[model samples]
Target: MSEIKKIHMGPAKCAVDLGDGSERGEYVNQDYILNKLGRPHRAVSLMYCYYPLDETWPARARNAFKDKEITFQWDYPYDDYFTYKGGIGGTTDDEPFTCMRDVRRHGQDVILTMTIDPNVTDEHLEQIGKELSTFGRMQLRINHEATGNWFSFTKRATYQQVADFYIHAREVIKKFAPNVQTILCIGGVEHPEKGGEIEMEKEFADAVRATDIWSVDKYMALHWGWPFDVADEGGNSFGRSKVADTYNLTKLSEKRYRELCGGVKKPMVMSEFNADGDVTGPYEQAEMVKEFCDMLKNDKDQGWFNGFTFYQFRDRGRLGLEIEDPNNADCGIEQPVMQTYKEIIHDEYFYPEMKSEGDAQFPVKLRWGGSEDAEGIEIPLHFEKNPTFCEITFEDEDADLNLMMEINGKWFYKAPHAKTIDFMSAFFEKPLESEADMTLKIFAPPASGENVNDGSEDWMLNTYSTITKMPNIRIRFAPILK
Candidate 1:
C-alpha cells in the first residue's frame, strides 16, 4: 500500500501572465484555451516600450491596449527619453494608454509600471496623475529594480531622489485617482549589493511610506550562461549548461526580502519570474515551475504575499512557456512547461472565481471489474437527484490516469492529457436528465506515437487490463430541485 498524501488546495489567489502582443492578430490564442483547455486565465499583462508623454501618445496607448481585462501594463520610459512636457516624441514600441475615454467608459483598473527620471518636472508628474485619475484605479510602479545597474535611474538617481519621486508621484496620483495604489518594485535581495551598499530603510525612507505593495523581480540564472559576477562577463562561464540544482529560489527571495525590507509590512508579489528555456530545457523549467509554486504556497508570507506574473506566454528571447514560431500564430508547440503551468494554475487556489458555493456532495466509487488484467474502471456517480453543477477531485499517483465523461452518447476527454490530474468540473445549462445513465471511465495514460493524429477518436481507443490501486477521489455536486 502506498502512503496517502493530501494535496492542500489553498484559498483563492491571483495568477497572471504576459501574453504575446506582437501584432494585432498575433495575440495569445483564446480558441486553444476554450476548445482545448476549457479554461480562462484570471488576468492578462501587457508590455509597453519607452515613450515620452506627448499629446498623441496616450491616444496610441488607448488604441493599442484598451482591453479592460488587462491587469498589468509594463512600460520603460526613462530619463533619457522623457521630460516635463515632452521630449523626443514618436511612437513607442507599445503604450499602456493612449486616451482616457476607454478608461472612463469601463472604469477598469490598470497595473501600470514605469521607470522614473531624476529630472522629471512637477508638470510631468501632474500630467501622469491627471491621466491616471480618469481610470477606475491604478497600481503605479516607479523605477523597478532601483538597486540594479541596468536602468539609468540606478546610476544617475540617488536613493533619496528615487524615494522622493515615488512619494511625489503617489501624492499627485492620489489627488485625482483616489483609488490608485502605489507599488515599490525592487530587484531581488540576492544581488542587493549590485548598485550600492546602502540600506533600504535609510535610502528609501520616504518611498516606503508611499508604497501600498512591495514587489521583487527574480530569475534562475546562476546555472545559465550568466557568470557568477558581472565583472566576469567575458569569462568562460558562458556554458554552465545545467539546470539550477537548488529549488529554493522563491524561498531565498522571500527570506532576503524580509531581511532587507522587513520594516515595510506590505503586500508582496513576484512581479517577474521565469526559468529561461535557453538556460534550461522545457523539462527543467517545468520542474522549477512546480517548485516555485510550492514555495509560494508553503514558505512565503501568505498574508503579505499575493501572487506572481510569469514573464512571457510564448518564447521570446530566453523566456516564455510555449515555443515561439512566427509562422504559427494560433499557439506554438506546447513546451513541457506549458502543460505543467496549465495544470498548476488550474487549481482553485489560483482561480478563486471558479470555487463552487454549493454544499451538495455526490458519492462516487471506482467499480473495478472484468479480468485481473483490466486497466480501466467504471466510476459510478450515485447521484440521488439531477445536478446543475458537478465536479470531481482526485489525486493520481502517476501520470497514467486518464479520465473521460459520456454525455448524450458522446465522450469528452479531460484535457492536460497524459498529465497527473488534480480535479475537474462540469456545469450544465439545464439540469441533468438522468444521473444513472451518465458514466465515466479511467484508463492508463495513452501511449501513441508522435504525429499520429488521424482526426478520429480511434487514437483514444485502448483496451489494456492492469488494475493496480484504487485512486483517491472526491465528488461534489450542486443539484437543482424542482
Candidate 2:
C-alpha cells in the first residue's frame, strides 16, 4: 500500500453545514467562499447524509465546486434521530455504499466517519469496515465520547470493551481505507448529560495508535446561548481579551494525543470550533482567527499540525447566530474584525531586489513645473562609473548655488570644493535615473541648527526628481565622467 501523506501548516479554511429539510439551502457555496476570501479553501465539511434530503447531494457539491480545487469531507449520518429517521430505515449498509458511489462519481474526496453509537452493533461495524475497504478515498471518525442516543463504552462497559471497539474499527478501516488519512475523536460538548465530565485520553490514545491522522472537537457553550464570559470560566473564555481559548484548547488536545501516540507524527485538525455569545464583531473575530494561526506558526516544535477549519462558514440559526447589534451600523459589513482578517489573508509584499557585484551609474536630466517659491533650476553632476569618489560642477555657479541635489529622497547641500567632496563614498550601490514627473521638492526647511530659525532664509537647494515604476530610484548616476 502507498504511504499516507501528512499535512503540516497552511491557511485555516472553513466547514459549513447545508441545513436540513426542504428549507435546506446552500449554507455556504464554494463561489461565495472563493470570492470573499480570494482563493479556494483547502477543505470543506458537508453536514448531513445524502439520502432523502439530498438525493443529488454529490451532484450539487460537485457543481458548487466544478472548476475549483478543494477537499470535501462528508460527515456521514450520525447515529441520531434526525439522520436515522430521514435515512432509509436507519440502516448503515446503504449509507456507506451511497456515499462511496457519490465520492467515486463526483470525483471528490471524503473523510468518512463511522458511527460509534451503541445502536451500531459489532456486525454493523464489520459491514462498515468492508465498505471502507471497498471505498478508495475515506477517513474514519472515532468517538471518544457518546453522542445523540449513543453511549460510550468508557462509561458503562469495561476498558476492554472500549479497546475492542477501537481495535475492530481500526482493522476494518485498514481493510478498506488502509492509508488511514484522518481520525476525528469527540472532545467535549457544552451540555453535561452527553457523556458529561468523561475524559477519554487513554481511549483516544489507543485509537490513534492504529491510525495515521487524528483530530478532536470542542463544542463550546458559547454557540449554544451561554454568556461570552462563561468561556472564561472553567478555562474556556471567548472574551476578546482572552483570545487564546481556541488556540490553547486545540493545542493542548493535540499535544496530549501526540504524546499518547508516542511522538505525534500526525496532524491535528480542529474538527469543529466556532464562536459563542454576542456574535463577535468582524475585527474581533478576525483577531480570534489570527490567534489560532499565529500560535501554530510560532510553535517551534512538533510537525503534525496541519491547519484549522472554522466550524462554520455562516451562522446557523440553531447555534444562536447573532449579529453584534443591528442598530450599531458600525458592526455591519465593514466590521473591524472582518476587515482585519481580510487584510491578514490578503497581505502582499514587494519582492527584494538582487544586488549586483560592481557599481553602475546612469544619469539623465529631469524637469517639472515649479511650485510656490521654487523656480526652474539646473543640476549638473558627474557620477563615477564604478569609482569610490566623484562630484558635480554646474556651468552657472549662481544657479547651482540657488539649487540643491536630492538623491533618493534625502537632500544634500552643495559644497564650494565640488571635486574635493567625494559623493560615491556615501552610496552603497550605483545610482539609477529618476523617473519623469517625480518631484525632487527643491525647497527649504525652517532653519533650526547652525542657521537662523526662520522660514525666510534661502536654502537654495536644486532637487532633481523623477518617478518611475522601477523599485529603486537615484539621480547621482547620470552624466558619467568617462
Candidate 3:
C-alpha cells in the first residue's frame, strides 16, 4: 500500500445561531463557547449571524475573537421580503455592515459564505464577489431554496440558479480570494421537499470545481431526533449495507459524498453536524463523535479526501430540552457529546495500533481457543511492554491450533501449529519499555465423530505460559522530549 496522507482534523466553530447575543442571556457567555470550541482536536466555531450590518454584530464578532474562535459566517443574501429578527437578512439595504470588516480589522481568520440568491444581478454578484475576494478565505453557501424570496425554488430554478451562481461566484472569488479554500453547500436534503435537491447539489458541485474551492456543507443529519419522538427520521445513510442511524452521520455522509464528487480534485467537509442536546442521549452523542473520528481515520487509511465540522456549539431555542433539575437553562454541558469531542482532541488512543515508537510500548494481548467437541476458550493478555518472544503450548491431544498475535490492536502474526515452532522469537528491533496490551487468538476446529472429517475428534487449546519483560530483551531509547 502507498503512504497515508495526513489531513487537517479539527472541530467546527460557532455551533449555534447568534441572535444579537442578548436572548442567550448568561447561557451565551464566551467562556462556555470557548470551552466547547477549544475542546475539540482542532478548534473551530460555526456562526450564522442574522445581519452583519447590525451594531451588535461587531460586538459578537469581537467576542468571538476574544475567545480565539474560528468563524464560519453563514451569509444570507439581499431580500426585502424577509425580516431577519436580529436585523440580518437583505445584505444590500443594511447599514453599518461591519461584521466582515470587524473580523478583518481584528486580524482574525473567517469563512464568509455567499448564500446564493437568484435575484442577484450580475453587477451585484460581481460586487459581492469582489468583497469576498478582498476579504479572502470566503466560502460560497448553496441552498436548495432561493435567497430571492427565502422559499424552495422550482426544479429549473434549483439547477440554473445554482449553476449560474457558482460560475459567477467562482469568477469573482478567483480574482479576490484566489486561494480561498472551501465552497460549502448549506442545507443538504434531509428530506428534500422536491427530490431534485440532490441532483441540484451535484450540478452546483460540478460548477464549484471550475473555481478551485473544495466542496462541503453547513449541516447534515441522519437521525434528527430522540428515541420515540415525532421528529425522528434518518437522513444520509451513505450506502452502508446496514444503516446504523445512531452513528454520526459524517461518516456515512462522507462515504456517499465521495461517490457524489468522485471525479473532483478537491476535498470535502461536514462543515456542520450535531444533534440537539435535548434530543440525543449523552452516551449516544459521545458515540457519534467517536464514529466521526473513526470515519476520518478510516478515510485517511483509504486515501480519500476532506475535513469535517460539528454543528453549532449550543442548541438554539428552536429545540426544547426537558430539564432534569432546572438549575440553569443551559443544557448542563451536553456531557456525552462534549466528552467525545474532548477525547478526540486529547486522547491519542483512538486507533489501537501504535504508529510511532513511543506508542509501541503499550501492547494488548487478545487470546482465543477451545475444544473441537463443544466449547471454546478465549483469554486477554496484557503486556507491560513489547515482548521479545511469545510461545503457545497446547495440552489437548485432538486440538488443532490456530493462533494469532496483534501489536497495538493491529494484526501482526498467525500460525497453524504451536509445537513445531523452531523460529527465532519474533521481536521488535526496538523494544518498547512502557506498558502495552497485545491480543492473541486461538481457534480449534470442531470435530465430526467420523473419520470422513479427518482424524481430529475433540480439540482444546490453552495458553500455559505468559511472560513480559524477558531476560534477553534489549532496550534502546531515544529521548522524545527535549
Which one wins by lDDT: 1 or 3? Answer: 1
TM agreement with the true structure for every prediction: 0.54, 0.45, 0.44
User: CA RMSD for every model?
Assistant: 16.9, 23.1, 21.1
What local lDDT score does residue 200 receive in model 2, on the 0 to 100 scale?
51
Ranked by lDDT, top first = 1, 2, 3
lDDT of 3: 0.34
Per-residue alpha-carbon lDDT of model 3 for 1-482, expressed as tens digits? 01111111112321211211111222233224433433112213223322243344324433433444322212112221122222223353331124433322221223443333444455544554443443333344433222222332222255656566656656764554343444545333333336424334555555544534333343223332222133333533211211133223333334444545565444445544444444344555455556656655554344343444454444432121122224655554455555556546444433111121111111222111211011112234455555544544444432233332222322222233333331122344335568754433222211110012123321112111122211121222333465
Ranking by TM-score: 1, 2, 3
Model 1, span 133-196: residue lDDT tens: 4333346667776655556466556767777777776787577555457777754444333642
Tell me which of candidates 1 and 3 scores higher on TM-score: 1
Q: Candidate 3: where are CA atoms >4 Å away?
A: 1-32, 35-108, 133-138, 144-156, 186-202, 211-264, 277-279, 298-302, 317-334, 347-482
Q: Per-residue CA lDDT of candidate 2, range 268-353, in tens? A: 66655544434453344555656655555566764546544444444322221223234542221223433444444443210111
lDDT, candidate 3, at 440: 37
Worst 10 residues of 2 by lDDT: 1-10
RMSD of 1: 16.9
lDDT of each: 0.45, 0.37, 0.34
